[model samples]
Target: MTWQTGLSGFLAGLLISIVTAPVGVSGAVFLLPVQLSVLHVPNPAVTPTNLLFNVVAGPGALARYRRNGQLTGPLARLLITGTVPGVVLGAIIRVFAIPGPQVFRLVAAAVLLPLGLWLCARALRPAAGDRPPLTRRTILGLGLATGTVGGVYGIGGGSILGPILAGRGTPMTHIAPAALASTFLTSIVGAATYAVLALTTDGDIAPHWILGLLCGIGGLIGGYLGARLQPRLPEKALRLLLGSLATALAALYLFQGLNPSGGN
Candidate 1:
């Protein structure tokens, strides 16, 4: 890659890491478009490459979360059990049914639109810090839905899981660590699944390892710093920011879906 492009990738990774890492995401949401548009590498490979980035970047954040005693193995297990199969289903759907960005974005936007509105509305209400814990059924459903979307979109379902739970007024103190652990494990499974597919199938999909690694390196540092900052950050302020960001991203993708001529 050119120096200019390399710089862009690193900076993008850093920025996304700071924005999302604090909330337990691995920066894949922002990186997907960069891969699709900037690198002009649009295919099934995009998702896994982002997953690869997660693999490289996740450990640093996970370490921080674990050190802080935020991560729980049981929670990770619960999330993964539901997410793994769901992601496999999503991968299959991407391969067979919704390969095009236009259709996929439309579907994604439709789902995110409601969630975004709910997040916004929730942001306006009084904070519910002592909300009831999520039921097993609820966790299962979240994992399935999140895994499927993560599989199709690339990255872990934490982007969906994090904000949705937060909107429900789950404490970020708990949500942050759990989401990070969940995303870390989810990315591992997703990456392995994609690697297997690459081996069995023709040369249709494979990660751009070099690029993914560079992004991951940047994300590692950013993620560490974000995690350190998260506890100090005000809960209400963070939720409002996330709610606004989610709605805006949904709207952008929805607009892009309408204007199919716009590449990536």
Candidate 2:
């Protein structure tokens, strides 16, 4: 990659993570657009590249959360349990089954649009206080579904999971670190899966290492700063922020899905 492209990747990761890390996302969901459009990274490979970014970038915000004693919890554990395997499966599917960009975009839009709207609606409602914790089965199911999507889309699944949890009344403090942790770990697995697939298969399946690392360097800094900022933001504001981001991404994907030529 050119220096200009590397710099652009860094800036994109930095800015996207600064906003998304506060909501437990590693910002790969946003970075996917940058990779596909501005950076002109090829498909399939871009998925692993995004996962690489999550793997490298996740530790920054996680470290901050750990310092504040918000890093580990039951929610985090359950999510990791389900997402790890699911992401591996998803990577396989991405490489072998559904390699087209249009299908993945449609799937992402279908999932995110309704959930984003629900989270926004919930945020606008009066506080009902903390609801009962989600059942282990429910959390595990969510992890599996979202992780599969993440593998296909190159996200850590936090962009999807965080909103759902928030809409169910989980506190931001609890959601942020947990979702990030899961994203980090799952991305590691997802990236590795893609690497292995690259050995056995053809086409652009492996990540662009230099580009991924450049973006990750920026993400690492941005994530740490965003985590530091998260504590000061009100819960409702965080929800709205996450909701708005999801909705916007969903719209973009929906358009791309409908008009394949435009996305290319």
Q: Could you say which candidate leads in TM-score?
A: 2
Candidate 2 lDDT, 1-264, residue by residue in tens: 799999999999898888888878668877887898899999878899999999889999999999999976788998888788788888888889888889878877876787668768877988777777788999889889888877877776655777788767787788889999999999999999999999999899999999999999899999999999987877577667767877898999999999988788
lDDT per residue, candidate 1, 1-264, as tens digits? 677766677777777787677776558876876777787555767778888888887777777877888886566677777777877777666666776778767765765666566656766887556567778789889889988888777767766677667665566777777777777777777787877777877644677777878888888887887888887876556556656766777787788889998646
| Candidate 1, RMSD to the unseen true structure | 2.3
List runs of model 2 lying over 4 Å from the truth: none
> Over the full model, what C-alpha lDDT does candidate 2 score relative to the true structure?
0.85
- Model 1 bad stretches (over 4 Å): 111-115, 128-131, 202-204
Model 1 lDDT at residue 49: 83
Candidate 2 lDDT score at position 118: 72
- Return the TM-score for each candidate structure: 0.89, 0.94
Q: Name the best candidate (by lDDT).
A: 2
